[model samples]
Target: MKYIKLAAVVVAASISGCATILSEDVATVNVATSTGKKIDITIDGQNYTVPGVVKLEKDGQSKIISTNDADCASSTAMNRKVEGVFWVNLLSGGLFGSTTDSATDAMWTYDDYVTISCK
Candidate 1:
């Protein structure tokens, strides 16, 4: 009887740990522009005005411009939720000789609910 109880306890602990790992919230956002034109971007209902000359980092690996109030809040929330890293990028055309003014697709991921905004 004691052996059976120990096994049951072990199984329960394993299941709980697995559940914790699976409960992390994560999401991704993709943005793209044409002609390298600057436009306002909205993610999760927040808006941000990104300049054509600025290249937003695709993942959390690069320096991020946290000037936007909403984007700053979102980043903070994400940092508290998941143990993994997130990314964001801007898709740009190959023209302009690798200039920041090129158009490109932007991608970003959040480990939890994030609000991004720019003005």
Candidate 2:
């Protein structure tokens, strides 16, 4: 019975938040404009719009932003972060957790939102 309990604990720990424990190769960034207008963005040559979300790989690609608003100006690159569950998995010995996270691109996360100035 003790062994079963221990095994259950190990399995639970290993599978917990597996998506967020291993992978972070992509991120979905929510973009917005200062004037509440839609804006255009180019990341590594891929075009996107603002007041919307874009899913991007975290492989060092940077956002090159633009807006139709003549007044609006510059913007910053989107941010990336390791998921909080990453540490938990690490501490739990991960085992299969790390593998799942890596395969599913859940080990990392991106900032939920960003804004661009058009003035």
Candidate 3:
């Protein structure tokens, strides 16, 4: 009975791993034009205004940032790797959680620390 209880506790604890708590499916990127102008911007086809922060989903999807400024160019970035917390989940026998997150696009996260200058 003691061993069974312990195993159950362990299993329950492993169900919600670090990946679920340490990361998210969205990323925020700061964007600006070369002239520090607030211009129209498109990220992954989503329309937004630059000189602002944009929140985007991360799931191995490549984000193409574009602008219409004559002196600037577009930029692209990709979320191609699973977050490190996913590995923590794997090591903790939380494969089910990790797999669930991946299937739900929750496990695929990227650093939300990027400044996308349109230049």
Candidate that would win on TM-score: 3
Candidate 3, 11-112: lDDT as tens digits: 777665566667765776665555676677787778998777888887666567776766566564544567777887887778877776667666665555
Q: Candidate 3: where are CA atoms >4 Å away?
A: 1-18, 33-35, 117-119
**lDDT value, residue 85 of candidate 1:** 17
Model 1 lDDT per residue over 11-76, tens place: 554333221232222233233232333456443345566442222233323222243333232232
Q: For model 2, what is the C-alpha lDDT against the true structure?
A: 0.67
Off by over 4 Å in 2: 1-17, 20-25, 60-69, 95-106
* Runs in model 1 lying further than 4 Å from the true structure: 1-6, 13-24, 50-119
True-structure RMSD for candidate 1:
17.5
In model 1, state the lDDT of residue 102. 19
What TM-score against the true fold does each predicted structure earn? Answer: 0.26, 0.60, 0.67
Determine which window of 10 residues in candidate 1 has minimal summed lDDT.
82-91
By lDDT, the best candidate is 3
Candidate number with the higher lDDT (2 or 3) = 3
Tens-place lDDT digits, model 2, residues 1-119: 99999999977876756555344557777778777877676666688877798878755334555544456665466655667776677676776776666566566666678788665
